[model samples]
Target: MKKSLVYLAVGMLIFTICLGSSLITNQAKAAEEYKISVVLKALNSDYWKSVKAGAEAAAEKYGVNLSVIGPNNETQVIQQINLLEDQLVKGVQGLVVAPLRPQAAKTVLEKAVSRDIAVITIDTDADFEGKTSFAGTGNFQAAEKAGKYFADILAGQGKVAIIRGAAGDYIHDQRVDGFMQGIEGTAVEVVSVQPADSSRGKAVNVMQNIIQSYPDVNAVYATNDEMALGAERALKSANQAGVKVMGFDGSPDALKSIRNGELTATVKQDSYGIGYTGVELMVKHLAGETVASEVPVPTFIIDQNNVDASIRDLTKAFSRDRLEVLFGEDVIAEVFAE
Candidate 1:
């Protein structure tokens, strides 16, 4: 009887050890399976592509499974919402998104939060509850700075027209309103404000119309580089000279335009930083670390005077050495090869 009891006790202890070992193994595997999804406003633009690159670098650094998806363009608000819903259905552990329309994303993002998924907004922000953090430029402040610069350059007096992005987009609204506020005390007159749906082609038509109505307009401010480039084209086509054009999102083409004295200046947002920080914050939040509600990336104005330096700085930011540092031995040599 005593020998039988000893055997039973030892067998029970063995079973307990095995169960604990299996649980630990499962936990480790779950950690390794961490998945993150990045949804952008659009993947068809250089600015969003830069953001994607930064997110890729961060995913490599953190050793997480990452997937990025987006609509064809920023105006496809419903498409973006549907994409987010699909990601949620996929049971993503983390989500980073640049909402085309914040309100449209609110309910879906709230659902994500309810599922215990960490949510971070990049480039554009949303007021959804339980959002992990926002990692992007302070649009209002940046646009205000651009406006003040314009006011100064135009000697506080000029006929200025504003070309906006998608109608009712919070990002563009903040920018347009901020620019208006910035020039309020100055003698600058806003001759027109029109929406281009954030499309370069649409902006060309809008600019042509503005030129027809406000033929003496001294300057134009576009909420984004695409629209600004279109405005510049329209101005050039019309033989309009000496009209300063300001753009946001200091994109590569916009920088080149500035260097060539086509576009006057642009507000340069840290697009890479926005992507990287969004992922970093999501990872940190998933790891149970506290993160700030707002993570403001840097922004500055780039123009003819600083275009060369800005280009050099951007080149260095994505140089081979920097890539190696960010991605370590996993960096693909061919991708950075001269």
Candidate 2:
């Protein structure tokens, strides 16, 4: 009888240990599947869409739930703030944001920090003190490269017109400042500087006015690829010849233009790196790992000399496998069918 009682007690102890271990394993698995959110400036551009694709790829690789949202245009300050509030109220564990304005979203981001949510900034930094870290390219440095190349091509003497993005945007301001610094010692006089609100149509109109006002303008510099392309259209329509055009962002359209001799040159930012690193850094922070406060992806100049190599780099950086998942295989086929 004593032996039988001892055997029964041992069996009960073993069953309890097994049950406790199972519970612990299940709890750990649940904790590992954290929910993260990504807020972009706008989804209207190919650049932001590519960023979304990279973020989705990272979420799939890391087994995290991700929600990406953006306003129709970067100027929609109220709509962006509302979206941030919605995410915060939904109790997201982590957030990655690209602020449209320098100081516009600081208050709302601080509210997220107050609620103990981890915040990461990408593409553009918020002026908020609450952000955990930032992952993006050095816009100022990239613009400086474009400016120096532009100045060198003109032999450092010409009248140049400037078309910039929306006012008060930190990234746009940095690009303008960097370009000014790059051409400081050169004689490339900037005859006019106008804001196009980052719109292709607006840029075209602005370019038209600039050409009329400064008929002797020998070159043009646009802060982004879209504006640059727009300026290209305006120059073509006006039948203006021999005026060099330099742009920022090595977008697909810009690359094709360079190949066809429509655009002079552009600076390429690592869009994929920004998105991929944003998610990776946020995950690391959640896992209690130390991460840098600001992670910068490098940039480079792409001109006729290195356009082919730049194309290869851009194709590899924008993953076809991951993009096929976000966009259907048919869409990818149509886009790259050439």
| TM-score of every candidate relative to the true structure | 0.85, 0.86
- Clashing pairs in model 1? none
Tens digits of per-residue lDDT, candidate 2, 1-338, equal: 99999999999999999999999887556546778999998888877877887788787777778899999987787888888889998879999999887487888889899999999999998767777899997888888887888889999989999899998778999899888888889998999989998888999999999989999998999999889989999999999988888888777678767867988988888777788889989888887889999999888888888776665555544667755554456745655654
Q: Candidate 1 lDDT, tens digit per residue, 55-158? A: 98888777778998999898899999999999988978999999988888999999999998888999988998898899999999999999999999999999
Compute the lDDT for candidate 2. 0.84
* Candidate 1 Cα RMSD (Å): 7.5
lDDT of each: 0.88, 0.84
Off by over 4 Å in 2: 1-32, 316-338
